[model samples]
Target chain A: MMTDLPLDQVRTLLAVVDEGTFDAAAAALHVTPSAISQRVKALEQRTGRVLLLRTKPVRPTESGEVLVRLARQVARLEHDAQAELGLSGEGEPTRVSVAVNADSLATWFLQVLTRVPEEFRLCFELRREDEDHTAALLREGTVMAAVTSSPDPVPGCSVRSLGRMRYLAVAAPKFAARHLGGPVARTLTEVPVVVFDRRDDFQDGFVRGLTRGRAGASALRHYVPTSEGFVEAVAAGLGWGLVPEPQADPLLGDGRLVGIAPGRRVDVPLYWQQWKLDSPALVQVAETVTATAAEALRP
Target chain B: MMTDLPLDQVRTLLAVVDEGTFDAAAAALHVTPSAISQRVKALEQRTGRVLLLRTKPVRPTESGEVLVRLARQVARLEHDAQAELGLSGEGEPTRVSVAVNADSLATWFLQVLTRVPEEFRLCFELRREDEDHTAALLREGTVMAAVTSSPDPVPGCSVRSLGRMRYLAVAAPKFAARHLGGPVARTLTEVPVVVFDRRDDFQDGFVRGLTRGRAGASALRHYVPTSEGFVEAVAAGLGWGLVPEPQADPLLGDGRLVGIAPGRRVDVPLYWQQWKLDSPALVQVAETVTATAAEALRP
Candidate 1:
């Protein structure tokens, strides 16, 4: 059957994904739970695809995530557009769409905001995603720009190299002494490790690189997804894993965390990609990000 | 003052710049010209910058583009979100955003529409732009995806090989005879050529490659910006140009145009870049385009 998706219903899907359940989405949207359920069901029927994995807090199916991301991006653009057009309601704020990795979001990506030109009032709607996957957000038109690993330009976007982010394998001195049991490399696989999530693979990649692809990190993995928490867990001697240079540096200095591999480090190059439109705000952002990366990342 | 630019206003600003006038943008947006004017003024005040260089069809100042892009991206996400949410208006169809080069649009890009999944039931909002510059649309989130010349992926998107698009140096038999009276290398500089616009450098680049940077193509140029018109202009003996294989094929077969540089040809590599969204619709599109390109473009 011929069907068209309304803007508000899409926004509702985003609300459900973000809020985690129909009840919460209903409360957020100021609609009833029944309305939320019906809306989601309608979406599924229209696309003939299952959108949500109905669990405790409703998690979006892959299709649902596409829509969730789409919703957030729409809200953000609508806000920016309204402001550009000087159309604003007293209570409504402009939403800016940005794609950032979960690590950056939990770390210093927010600092990018502190640098925004304050004279031009703008609100931000941030999309937390894997940096490796953030560019997909741009392709789906989910965000205006993104922080990504690829140096190649996205369709219709210009690219600037941001530089590499270095990571070190470290753990608290006490924990290392207990779990690592002296020679670090020899016993790493035997010791338990902390992983950010099932998607976490840095530890495995590092081990593979070290062992020439013979092994992966310990299978006894503790899933701690938050950046701050992951760092803390490693600092608490939970497991040895990759940590950003800056975070590892202070801890190394204070003798809190000891590096298993002191000098050898892996550097993941980062790049800033944005649409080629000559938008004043995006340019300002690209400039700021470029400047920041110059200082914070490897040359 | 602390100002937040709304997404819709930013979008309207882009529409004005793209359409080249407030009234045209109004028509495109289904709003009155007064509303368009007011929106732009608000954006200017909020940014505390003169964003638009107001003229017959106003142009955005360097500052204005940032907001415009943000708006377009939001619109794209809105489209995607609406599709996922299945919110339909009585007859309004969901629009899909794509960034395509003028040459491709003039040739086979439209054919992609026939291959789309019938369930998508979408409208096409194709942005006419240069291939070299199409990636900018992805970065700005103006379109969900684009066909670009860069081999690299955009910041937050993935890249797939589409293959090289070959361009042949051809001229109308009359134009070639007049302009290329002597050895082409020696006389091409004085010969007039057809170009897309002021920024177009295809013919000049072709000349430079042949001449080892000693000289550029004709200083005298006839700007026939449209691809079909550009080819027609050349066939009508206006000047020589680098024509895409498809457009130049029929003309060459019929003897309307002749190749100037027999062995010298330019093969520009094209790629498909899109947001890394985990959506089936986008993935399907990318696959279809890649498969098509595999057959159509040079390996």
Candidate 2:
């Protein structure tokens, strides 16, 4: 029946998660370790949900992580609000934290920073994450906004569509000639492929669309975590991949890579999802990002 | 450089926004109006950004919105942490705020709530926004997590690929027969269509795909905002519309509506984006959402 939570307890959970232990939280708050432990125990009791796992360091339980994220975001907004009211201190610039995916960072996400006006005296803590999972950072209050694939907005936020990013499946001209024989829809499953990571479904998803679940590309995998390296791996003939068309275009034109199947492309529609706050910094970032996306991505 | 903004300034901004005047902020903070104005001026000087509009009911600038959201999120986490640390009053519960889109809410988003343990004693404040913009809520620290269209996680959040939501264009058999002629790909552009709001483009995108940019859905549009209402509007013979197959299936079976074109469906790939925190509630939500989406959506 508990319908409301005090903000202080939520913040304590974040600190515990960040610092990794009740003892550390106590030190940060200049309180006794026992006090920190008691507060956490009390919080769990109220929520009837275990908010943290009391490991050596400490971890927010699935429920706890949600609250921890809430805490972090609250702190960020509070900072901005104070400065707006002109009650800021003599020293210290505020940190604007954000989480974004790798592909966008490589493409246009970084450019958002370039637009932040010189006056906000803002500091940045950029978290590199996959677009598919960046909203998790927002939930955890680890970052303010995300570049994501979902058309649905996260809880308590607003959403705007950025545009669609076009990705093409290409390979070295010689590799295609040697490996792919007939219609791409038919030969794709049997061909070798370079995968970026274990979780990567780009190659498999591409194959699935073609064969309608018949099979997938060769399992010979090259796990390059970085976007640049992933593209390079494909270019080096490690295997064919579904590369971003922008990245693949020049290579294809130069005869370095050829379309195993031309005229077919995958359009990944991207959107910018962020907290629905009225912050100058966030708006500036959004404006720049949307504008850039319009230029770089297909409308 | 202000690496970290002070918590106090942020709180003041919130007070001002909520109170809607410098004097109101002063009253809330137990300070003079002059003091309030001075604090805001000081904050603007420090950030070098104008954070607010000097209005009767103040509005935040783009930069100011960021601060508002940040303050809200920070406050949320603080409370959760306090409760977890046993710092809350004996009967206090935690409020977990989230941003979500209307469609998911009408569909399977509520299932996440079912998975929550009753003892967690949580109250949810759901914000209704577009999926494409949910991440903005996270960026503003307005909500801890969101179900968004973007795959790029919010700055500090984590993201997971939930699955794909499929939509099919359908209408009441009467409506389809009256407005759309033979071969939907050819006739759809001329048919009246149902859209959500000024921003609705699902139908337009579909038509563009069908006509290869040569045409678009009728400018004769009907705006129905709600998901259920929109489907009903189409079924009522107002217009042909793109409907999530799940919602359209029964209507089609009952002969209330018919697919303008069969076997042609659009699948919007979805992802679950949240903060990267390990809170028990957030984790539980993620698992439930992922599982539910797996069951409800096309892989």
Candidate 3:
């Protein structure tokens, strides 16, 4: 089956998907539109599956997504090979893209980038997504690696434990006095809250755990998507929230933020997942990230 | 026709879209599955078009999206009315959701939030998307306002000119000497560049402007998704890029970075857009944002 798939046909399919149309793909690849169409048709014939939904700016069918993933993996391997063989253009930097959570980006991830040897001349492309969703980027082949909450590896990737990131339920002193001074769980469900985003469940989960599933954070919520700003929002008495320890510590020490639920915290376990490849650059990044995570996150 | 479209039915449509399933929507709305089905049927009858694509997890058709947007607007109006009438729950903060770009968020947008009067007790929910895309959130009714690049207003929203955000092409002095010593326009096409993300076109636009559309920024690019980090990456000599003037000035003055093309700059005109509602809270926010933008950005 591997022998049956030709690289050229697979590449044409990828170009078509990326360019959004056969003509655009042809223009990008410097090939005729008919040639792009023929190669895609040939790939479909070989695979025995309809690969694309021919819409305005075509979309990949489920089967096409699988092939697109394979194509990207192959491209990554080829690019690594060229770099290793010294066939790459002079001053060409090896690019590695990763999807990271916002908290990780703001806190310790930049430190990991600094740890990678500068001799590699690596270029980094970072995507910010939720920890729960970063793995999806890896699965879609949009990123070569990810800092994700999922323990399960993306198909061709390997996962390693990157310690737990702890969040402390916090509020401003005045806010705690007014809203959170009552029954902790019940009042939490009734008072205004701060969430990271619409998808953020950290506060609700904290409330649920506190109330034994009887309550969740109030719907009157402020969603401040950035990690640093989210901490600031809570400290400014906008609403109580579960803030990452790294971000919450300074404010807590300065009396800007107070722990609403003392001794109660949420620890979200994170994992580093990367393509299972022998690329030295990728290995360097993974090792640096793993080492940094070990020191920065709770064990 | 507007009277015929009941609020409950419109809200039910939004719930179905949000929850992604009829049963989930039913549970959320505290109604039975049969009631959800009937309400949806009545809505389709009233609209004379199928509003939903009843897949495993429901999806809204084009007409459904229209009604979902309407439902959100109505909710915003109702919430504003309650606040004005003092019928809101005690200590309920006036909530305002705004979609802002990361650059604006990092630079001057947060200041606008601080300028809001404490008496209003506004709870801000900020969504950080690219400036070019923030208006989509407004159109979808996910956000009540946005900071956008486009001067054109999202339907039902009014627009106000903020000012032009100037971006200067810059690099570390060492990097400029090494790679940018030749003809500025030609060398830029060959040298590595730092881009904000895949969607970023500022660098390419700069190169195009420099070369009279004959060239573009290098394909050898580092994609740093965050605004502050993008500046840091450029200052650290990863690659040259079009840095926002507000962020670039400090680094350049400190000798960490230098202008690659001394006088070359791109000015992206920004605008403040918000729902055309008489909510004092939204108006206060708009006024503060516009005032700040006037001071902080180039008119």
Candidate 4:
């Protein structure tokens, strides 16, 4: 079934998706816009699927995403072959991109790079997104690998458990004393809370568990989007939040922050997903990242 | 022409796109999947255009994006009307979502939140994206407003100049003495640089300017995705990179960081863009954000 798909059309589909317009894709692929259009049309006819939405910045239909993923895998294989064959262009560093969550990027991801041998001569591009959405990049063929919360493999990728990342509900000592002096569940609903963003529901989920799903975190919440700054905001006595365990440790020990629910915490299971290809660079990254996660994260 | 598009069908179409699947959209809209399919099909028939690509997660066609924008405008108007007539649901906070860059989020953006009047009962949802891409959220209706690098307004939105964010080429004193003790242009390519991520080119641009466009910053760069952390990494002597002027001031004043290039700097002009509607909540937020940016950023 896969053999029926033409390589040029698949690569053209990826170019159009990446460049966002037929004209731009043509410029990127060094062809005419009409050529780009005809190629896409031919590919759609061949696949018997509507491949694109043709938006201002073009969006791939689900069918198009499949082809885009295939294009990336092919590109990865070609790059690896070039590298192994000593045919890589002079001084052209091999570039690898990975999508990672903010918490992991802030906490322990750098150590992975340190472990990479200088001999690898690789350049890394990191995309910071939420753990739940990191896999979307892999699905889109934007990143070769991702540190994602989903255990499910993005088709063509293999998944391995990286263990659970624990989070603690904590607040500045002064803030807890001032605003959280009452009953845990009810008081949480009344007091101000800090969240990573509107999409962040960890604190609300924690509150719901305590209140039997009767209430949510306060509507009067502070949206601090960065992981490091989120902890800083909580420690600065702005609001209480569910802070990642490692980030909260020093603050908790130094009394800058106090655990409100010492017995309650959230453990988000993380997984490392990468393309199932025989590429040395990708293999080294996976091994290094997995090894670091094992040491830094709780199983 | 506007009357031709039924409000229910329009809303349902938005639901389908947002929810990603027909079944999910039906569940979200509290209707059967068959009903959702019928509404969308009817809408497409009336418009004489294919509105969606029926894939796993359906994508809105270009024409569909137009209707989605219309649906969002209608929703905003309805919410504003309810608020004005004092018919808003009990304890319903006026929610305002804004997309901003990391530098703004870490620095002056929070000040806008602090200035929101308590009487307004506003809930802010800040979406942190790159400044160049934040306007896409506005265009997609994911955010009501955005701080963008481009002055061009998204359709159905207005734009205002927010002034320039200056970035200085900086490094730790020890790093500068150790690695950058030679000619500025050529040495910059040899020394490691710190960048916010792969998309970051400020350091490369700085180096290119010095070298008459013959070179770029080192490929041996450290990728730090957070603004604050990027500065900290540079100050820790990991690499030399461009630091936002405001964030770099204290470090420069304290001698933790040194200017790599005395005169060379990058000034990224920013602008605020928002929906062109007369909602009091939106108006208040715009005024607050604009006033704060005027004070905090350079014109």
Winner by TM-score: 3
Between prediction 1 and prediction 3, which has the larger DockQ? 3
Candidate 4 ranges beyond 4 A from true positions: A1-90, A139-141, A155-161, A173-175, A189-192, A197-199, A213-223, A232-239, A253-256, A276-280, B1-90, B172-181, B189-201, B212-224, B232-239, B253-256
What C-alpha lDDT values do all the predictions have? 0.72, 0.72, 0.85, 0.85
lDDT of 4 by residue, A1-299 (tens): 98888999999999999888999999999999999999999999998999999888999887888899899889888988998899987556767788888898888876776677767776677778876567667877788898888888988799999999999999999999998878888999878788887688888899999999999988778777888778877887767999889999999898999999868888999899888888899899999999999999998
After superposition, which runs of candidate 2 have C-alpha atoms over 4 Å from their true positions? Answer: A1-4, B1-299
lDDT over C-alpha atoms for residue A233 of model 4 = 75
Residues B1-299 of candidate 4: C-alpha lDDT, one tens digit per residue: 99877999999999998899999999998889999999999999999999998877898877887788789878888988998898997557777888888888877887787687768877777777886567557766778899888788888799999989998989999999999878888889977778887677778888888999999988777677887667777887778888888889999999999998898888999899998888899999999998999999998
Which digits, one per residue and each the tens of the lDDT, describe model 3 over residues A194-281? 8888888889988999999987888778788887777777887878998889989998899999998878988989999988888888
Interface RMSD values, listed in order for every candidate: 25.6, 24.2, 2.4, 2.8
- Candidate 2 lDDT over residue span B1-299, tens digit each: 43477668877887898788998899889999998888777777778899898977997777887777667766767777887887977445555555656566556665554456657655444555676568666765666777766788777677888777788889888787676777787778766677766577889999998989988886656555556656766776767888987888889899998988777889887777676665666666667778888888788
Query: What proportion of the real contacts between chains A and B does each prediction keep?
Result: 0.00, 0.00, 0.51, 0.34
Deviation of model 3 at B256, angstroms: 3.8
Candidate 4 chain A has its poorest 10 consecutive residues by lDDT at A88-97
Ranking of predictions according to TM-score: 3, 4, 2, 1
User: Mind giving the per-residue lDDT tens digits that candidate 2 earns over A80-172?
Assistant: 888888877745466566665556655666555445674765544555567556766766666777777777887646788988888888887
The TM-score that candidate 1 achieves is 0.40
Q: What is the TM-score of chain A in candidate 2?
A: 0.90
Q: Give the distance in Å from residue B38's predicted Cα in candidate 4 to where it truly belongs.
A: 7.5
| Ten contiguous residues with the weakest lDDT in model 2 chain B | B90-99
